[model samples]
Target: MDAPPDIHSLLAVLDRDEWFSSCASDLKLALVRDARLLRCLAGEAVYRDGESARHALFCVVEGAVRFSSALHDGSPSLLVYLEPCHWFGDISLIDGSPYIRDAIADVDSQILCIPMQSFTQWLDQNPKHWRDIARLSTNKLRVAYQVIGEPGALHHRLARRLWLMAHGFGSRMQNPSLQLSVSQEHLAQMMGSTRQSINAALARLEGLGLLVQGYRSIELCNLENLVNHANRLGGE
Candidate 1:
């Protein structure tokens, strides 16, 4: 049994986050003061695709959230997993549109929910701060573009994905843990490759001393080497 997250620990994680770290103390307080922490068990839906808009901001404080969607035939498609200190629900928050993807808990997780009403009142007074909110969505959009446009062989793509996940998809944490909590099946879904193919790629990476695969997890042994391999083998 793990202990529940405390405010002190939560603040520490926010300090490491790229966007939150740069925010003014008042802005940070404004966001955190009225927030409520919600605990979601594994395999739960934080929010589903095409659901009516419930405007709120969210920050993952513990565990991971899976962003997924459905195919034409209604098959599920896993996009990526977001870890601690990652903010989401911004796209819908910005445009006032319904959520486009399903946000599901990949594990038992703690998430901070800030109602839009509170922020809406604040933003009405401080409209300039809307840019800060935009930054959150745009930062994620940048990562999405990188992932979608990533080119190369399956092995190369896998290496880059491992590196990106370890680094929080370019969020640049002060201290990034190299361990990734995701199964090969999830990886296959993310990379649009078969699970067997992902297994082979993982074996190749493991043989190269780049990573070690565990049960539902992967430990990046050499981040630099992994990126190098991806760029070298990942053709232009």
Candidate 2:
């Protein structure tokens, strides 16, 4: 296996993307000024539900993190999986409230933790970057709305999610396939469906020749067909 990347090196990678780099620079200047970087092993909880949201927003420099909220009985329902260049804790960071959700490392992860006070101070000092923050916030809201409004069908929801992930992360890969290493249980939680429903949908998609499922990898076999199906579902 390849060696893991350091936090500073991860920051450099985020810096290569114009929008991500600018926001990261502002966040880094505010919080991680001289702070030591931390590492979280796979399956570790970055922040548990109901914990004080004291830390600044966490940027996924490398590896993946899953943001989830507890069900009535305290079982976690995965909301989404975030990878490199994605930031979380925005709601708590903005509202100064305890984190409403729990964040866990899905793999060996490197993240930058900026203090909340420092982030607010930097925002106060530089008003221009706030526009970028606003855009990011708006985009997040749009996604939430789309996901929330989706139909109850598990395959429909999964197809939409795969499309979004492919559009977001596929450019870096040679084939641009959405090969998320997530389990069916996690997918069911994210989609607010049961494991049976998720499995059925995956099977249906495989039958339709739109996806290829291996042990832990799912490849988008036909992007156009997937997009068309997503659009038709959205229109319904």
Candidate 3:
């Protein structure tokens, strides 16, 4: 795995990230100066549910991260997969509430963290920046709504979810294939089904030449075929 990026590289990342690109010049510069980079290995927990959200905010600069939430008994389920340019934990920083989900690196990841105090002070100075955060949240809600439209046949639902995962989450691979850095159990939770069901769906997809499953990861072998299958279900 790579080491944390230097301040200069991280500053460029902040500038390019959709979540912060529209910030006022002063706020943007302050974020860059106050931020630090952290490198997380695969499967490392960036933050856990119910923990005090004291680590400020994390903007993914490389690789991917997954968010999950659990019941009272501690059984967890997938919430979302975040890619580079996406962020997590901002709500905790704003509302002083503990995070509702866990953030874990799906692969070796480089993250830029801004301390809560710095982020808060900058936002205070630029109250207009609040709109950007709101926009991000609204977009997420919109996507969630689209994804949750009346559940249907298992293969259709599984195909829809896989398509979303492949395109919604960014990757560094040169080929169009997407490597989901998650297991079948986690995917089962995301799909709201049992592991057996997910396994069956995966086997069907592989048999149809749409995917290639690996140990702890999955790759889409036929993007067009998957997209066609997903589009047959619903629009994103």
- The candidate that achieves the highest lDDT relative to the unseen native structure: 1
> Model 1 Cα displacement at 96 (Å)?
0.7
Model 3, span 30-84: residue lDDT tens: 6656676778999898888898876567788888888987867777778787777
Under the 3 Å rule for N, CA and C atoms, how many clashes does model 3 have? Answer: 0
Could you tell me the TM-score of candidate 3? 0.78
Model 1 ranges with Cα > 4 A deviation:
1-9, 234-236
Ranking by lDDT: 1, 3, 2
For residues 50-92, what per-residue lDDT tens digits would candidate 2 score against the true structure? Answer: 9998775776777888988888987778888877666667778
Better of 2 and 3 by lDDT: 3
Error of 3 at 69 (Å): 2.8
In candidate 3, the residue pairs with backbone N, CA or C atoms under 3 Å apart (3 or more residues apart, or in different chains) clash, namely none
- Score residue 147 of candidate 3 by CA lDDT: 76
lDDT: the better of candidates 1 and 3? 1
Query: What C-alpha lDDT, on a 0 to 100 scale, does residue 214 get in candidate 3?
Result: 96
Q: What is the C-alpha RMSD of each candidate to the true structure, in Å?
A: 2.9, 4.3, 4.3
TM-score of each: 0.92, 0.82, 0.78
**Between candidates 2 and 3, the TM-score winner:** 2
In candidate 3 the C-alpha lDDT for residue 102 amounts to 80
User: What C-alpha lDDT does candidate 3 achieve relative to the native structure?
Assistant: 0.72
